[model samples]
Target: MRKLARWHIWLGWLAAVPLLIWLGSGLFMAARPIEEVRGEALRRAAVPMPLSGLVLPREPVVATKLALVDQRGRPTWIVTDADGATGRYSARDGLPLGPVGAAEARELVAAAWNGTAALSALRRFPRDAPPGDLRQSRPSWQATFADGAHLYIDADSGAVLAVRTRWWRAYDLAWGLHIMDLQTREDSSNAFLWLFGTLALAMALLGAALLFRRRRTATGRRA
Candidate 1:
């Protein structure tokens, strides 16, 4: 029982570290509404897509999905084929438009950003090697603002992929700590996580046994 108590005490301290990380991260993530954390208001308001003189894709697209969107004051048709390949075309003339170039990517970010700080830098990330701030595997352009806000644009589709702030990066770190996967930040069932979780449960059981034993001893003394 004494050895059990000592083990429980040490294990409890170890468990407390991750539990506190989980608690703090949960509070920080929940402090603001999800939309605000995502910096939705920093984006320009959407004008109704003007497709009055609409023309469809000339080539036969085995389309799995399609969207009519406004691209830099022009109507664009974003097409996704059955094999999950995406393409962009002009809705006005059915002409092929993207794989977005750097200059156009700059224009796209400028038009989309409604924040006060001016754009400080623009960088590109390859499909295989992407910024940690971005969640997608596709190639992208990152427009960074003076305020530490980063807006990611799809290199192939010219779409706004994600908006991340400094706080979001902190949240991401917290998530990695909470999940015990600081490397990938996605693994929830790693060996370290399971081992620590088992230790925490054992500590709790040991604590309960100690409490029960003390209560019974006190009752017998009173009797």
Candidate 2:
């Protein structure tokens, strides 16, 4: 009984670490609105898309997806063909434009940023390492505002990929610790979390046994 109680106490402490991470992260997520964490509130008001003046290619583009997105402050259509070729067309005359540069990237960030913070950092990632949201759109630009908001823009097409804030970063870190995926901060369905969960359950069962054993001993002494 003594050995079992000692093992239970030690295991409980060990299990508490992961449990606390899960609880703490869950609490933070529940307390904060998800929209704010995603930085949706910091985005600029959407511009009305122009439809009548659109001039598609005379040749069949055979596009898989067509998205009307904001480039700098202008509206543009990004077309992805069936063969995975992407091109940006002007909204007014459908003229193709060159790839996004530093100036256009900064303008895109400024357009999306509704906060009072100025530009703190603006860097480009040339298909090397991307943030969680920009994984699909590699070679992007990350513009960080002084208010702890980050905006990611596609370097190729000048599209705003995603917006992230400091709260999102904290939530991501907590989620990684809770799920035990420190590498990519994804994959919540791994076996490592299951192993720890099983051990924690065993510790709880042993703790219950110890409590019952102590209660019986006290009753016998009173008798």
Candidate 3:
């Protein structure tokens, strides 16, 4: 009984060092703000996408082939088939175009074809009464363009519910750092985290083994 008690105490002490380190590190990591980490990561992950030319419409057809120019001014074509018919070699990488419903097709045209006109119409629409006003306002979602323009979407139907102008602010450098995991978003998904955990566990186990061996040796001597 004495030997067994001594062994347990020794094992626990051996495990104590690694156990302490693991607890301390985990507590520190958990204390960090997730939002700060996410913003920094977004900033670091930022990269410019190549600009493709705008697709211009040719006719008043429900759907038309859109003409586009690459960054180098080279022309490329994409079919904006809105008719919802599955026609081969139409556009979007030779995918079928057209045969879509009239209403959906119209919405697509309004969004892609008449970008400027759509913005103007949205601006002219009267603003909904604020919260607690006499008139009830419908809930909506919104997307902001790079040029400070906003396209309010219907939350339920995912439709372009409205369009308007709004403020725009770019993410700060810290956000980029967080996104990249360079400064803020600790590379928790990487092998390093796993390595650390494994090492900690191993150290704890090793300490326990040392304690057991010591107890066994002491017991044999007493016997």
Candidate 4:
């Protein structure tokens, strides 16, 4: 009985830290507005696609998903093939303008942002196995505003992909801690967490059993 109590205490203490971290981080995440963390409120609205003057290629471009996306108030055709190749072309003559550059990325974000914050930093990532934010569009630009807001623009399409704020960073950090992944902060499938969780559950059940035994003994003594 004493041995069981000791094991339960040890396991409970071991599990307490992670449980508290999970609770604290979850509370903080819930307190912050999701929109603010995602930086949606700071983004500029995409203008309507201008299809009136569009001159699409008569010779069909074999693509899986092709559509007109707003590019700095102009209509631009975003083409993606079955092989997952994407490009931005001039709607005027179907001329391939190629991927968007750093300048265009900045322009795209600035035009849409209603905030007075200036573009503080701009970086282009290659389209090959990029970071988590640019995983969908490998080659993308990360435009950081002076207000600590980051706008991810697809390099090929000149489209704003995602907006991230400092609040998001905090939330992301908390999530990483909760999942026990500090480096990439994404590996929730780790075995260590599972092992510790199981131990904690076992500890709780054993403790409950001990309490019930003690209560029954006290009742017998009183009677």
Candidate 5:
């Protein structure tokens, strides 16, 4: 029993801070509505555009899939090749549309943004260099709005990829801490998490044992 107390005390000192952090972060995450945390209101609803009066590209490319959608109020073809390359072309003339430039990216985000914040800045990320927050390997334009929400636009298709709000980034940071993934913040199966989780469980079990032991001692004394 004495050895158990010593072990519990030592483990308590080691795991207390982490446990509190876990609890606090978890509660902070759970307290808010998931939709708000995800910034669903900031996204513009996608309207389905009919594929009528279309002209396909005759560039002798093997395409795995195709989508005809309205981009900037004009019918466009988004072609997906067998090699996983995606390109946007004009459905009006079947000519390949150029990749989204900085001006077009800013205009796209501003027009599509449902939020009232004014679009502030747009930065282009080339295909060879992708932003860390995007988590996808493709050319993109990151647009910053006045509300501190970042909207990502596909550089090729001029499509809205994602809208990450301030709250969303905060939650992401907390998730990294909770999962114990300091490096990439994507790996939940890290060794550090497993080690600390095991220690926490052991500490809990020892504390339970001590509680039962104290209760049994009290009952014996009364008898």
Candidate 6:
């Protein structure tokens, strides 16, 4: 009985350090805000761009096309989709500025050609509009640009209403690291987390069983 108890205690102690380290790190990360981490990663990944001459557009323009225009309206970096169904992103900053849908595509064309209501609204609205004005009732995704800019596009409407950057680069970087794993799909990456969790549970169960066996043997000896 004594030998069994001793073994269980030693084994439990042996597992304790790694378990604590893993748990503590996880809890600390969870408690921290996501935005801070994401911002940090963005800062690290950011690349500088030249202020002069014609800017070149980035590849994979199928997702989004980006063009840099000067005050005179001459395009320095003209990024547009050949199919015209997708959006365009600036090669310099990777900031998506245009999206294409039936209505959205028309809006983009009008904004580019006629300088209509949509363009007027976009220009009039504060670049960093108040949170209350931008709040929506639906789920949406936001992306940070390489030039420390942010673009919030409505998922349902596909309208980009606001674009600006905040100083929380570290938070954003941390979030990106936490959510992005090497796996192609997010679910597969999550499986690794579950695997570690299961290991911890099995270790706990084995420890409990050893303690129970020790108690039983001691009781039998006394009886």
lDDT of 4 by residue, 1-223 (tens): 8888889899888888878888898898898788877777788666666467788744468988877876776677788889877877777778777677767777887776766788888898887756564336467888878988778888877867777778888888888888887777878888877877787789889899899989999999999
Measured with C-alpha atoms, the lDDT of residue 212 in candidate 3 is: 83
Tens digits of per-residue lDDT, candidate 1, 1-223, equal 7988898899899889877877787788787777777888899887697556799988777898998888899888889887667889988899888599889999999889988988999999999999988977889999999999999989988988899988788778878887889999999999988988898888899999988988999999999
How would you encode candidate 2's per-residue C-alpha lDDT over 178-219 as one tens digit per residue? Answer: 788877777888888898898899999998999999999999
Q: Arrange candidates, best lDDT first.
A: 1, 5, 2, 4, 6, 3
Candidate scoring better on lDDT of 1 and 4: 1
Tens digit per residue, CA lDDT, model 6, 15-122: 566466555545656765565433333222222445654435454444255434431233334443565333344434544545333454334323323111132222
| C-alpha local distance difference test of each model | 0.87, 0.79, 0.38, 0.78, 0.83, 0.43
Writing each residue's lDDT as its tens digit, candidate 5 over 1-223 gives: 9999999998888888779878988987887788998788988876676666778875666778888767777777888887767888888889889988877777788667899888888899987888767767788999888998888999988877788888888888788888888668899899988888888898999999999999999999999
- Expressed as tens digits, the lDDT of each residue in 61-90 for candidate 3 is 455544332211223233335642212122
User: What TM-score does each of the candidates earn?
Assistant: 0.90, 0.81, 0.24, 0.85, 0.90, 0.32
Better of 1 and 2 by TM-score: 1
Q: After superposition, how far is residue 193 of candidate 1 from its true place, in Å?
A: 1.4
For model 2, what is the C-alpha lDDT against the true structure?
0.79
lDDT of 6 at 177: 40
Q: Which residue pairs collide, candidate 4?
A: 44-112, 127-138, 127-139
All models, RMSD in angstroms: 2.0, 3.2, 17.8, 2.5, 2.0, 15.5
Badly placed stretches (over 4 Å) of model 4 are 50-60, 128-137
Error of 5 at 125 (Å): 1.5
